[model samples]
Target: MVDFTPVPALCGGLLIGAGASLLLLGIGRIAGVCGIVGSLLDAPRSPDAGWRTAFIVGLAFSGLVGFALAPASVTNVANSPPALVGAGLLVGYGARLANGCTSGHAVCGIGRGSTRSIVATCTFMLTAGVTVFLVRHVVGR
Candidate 1:
């Protein structure tokens, strides 16, 4: 049966926002996964690599810890490896083309009152809604 755990979800959202806020305060950088990963790859000798690498590592480590604590709650979908890879590639490409991602545009950008971010976030939400509808209805999940 499905469960509605609003407390955990709210706590998680608060933690994410707090983490992003702290990152912005400490390093003046947006805590966007795509931007962080992309910049890490783009600059081989950049000093920012240290923090960026640490950030990515921390994200992975957090997921591992969460999964360890709640194995059943962790997502273990059975999608094909190739399909996952293709989706990852498409998402990466889209993030690059969009100049930011959900984290950057929705969280940081909205906090900063950016018009572009608002537009991007709205567009992203609309597109995601349509995609989900199509997948669940037209494409049969």
Candidate 2:
């Protein structure tokens, strides 16, 4: 069974919301991580590279901080490194196809009342639910 910690979840949600809001308010850019990383890869010397690098670096730093604060909470459920890498690649591809990641659609787009983002976010959630159900129940993983 999964351990659900409401406090940590709430805190994480708040932090994410705040970060997204700050990015939009401060730089007038959506906090879509995939787009940021893609932009960096496509144009390393672009004018916006500084903020993109900082945002990506901040994400990595935050993960390190989380692991340092609660080592037990940083556990990886995936046992195979290849599987994890494949999953990451698939997610990146999906985000590129969808034009935005969950953060950009669900948080920032929904906040701005975007119809396309709303539909995309719903589709994302539905797909995720079905995938999890199939993997855990049908596949007995």
Q: Of the candidates shown, which would achieve the greatest TM-score relative to the real structure?
A: 1
Q: For model 1, what is the alpha-carbon lDDT of residue 36? A: 93
- Tens-place lDDT digits, model 1, residues 1-141: 899899999998899899999999998989988999999889957999999999999999988998899887677667799978987897899998888998989988898999999999999999989988997899984
Every candidate's lDDT? 0.90, 0.90
Task: Compose the digit string of candidate 2's lDDT tens values, residues 1-141.
Answer: 988799988998998999998998998999998889988998999999999999999999988998999898677685589978888998999988888988888888898999999999999999999988998899985
Q: List candidate 1 stretches off by more than 4 Å.
A: none
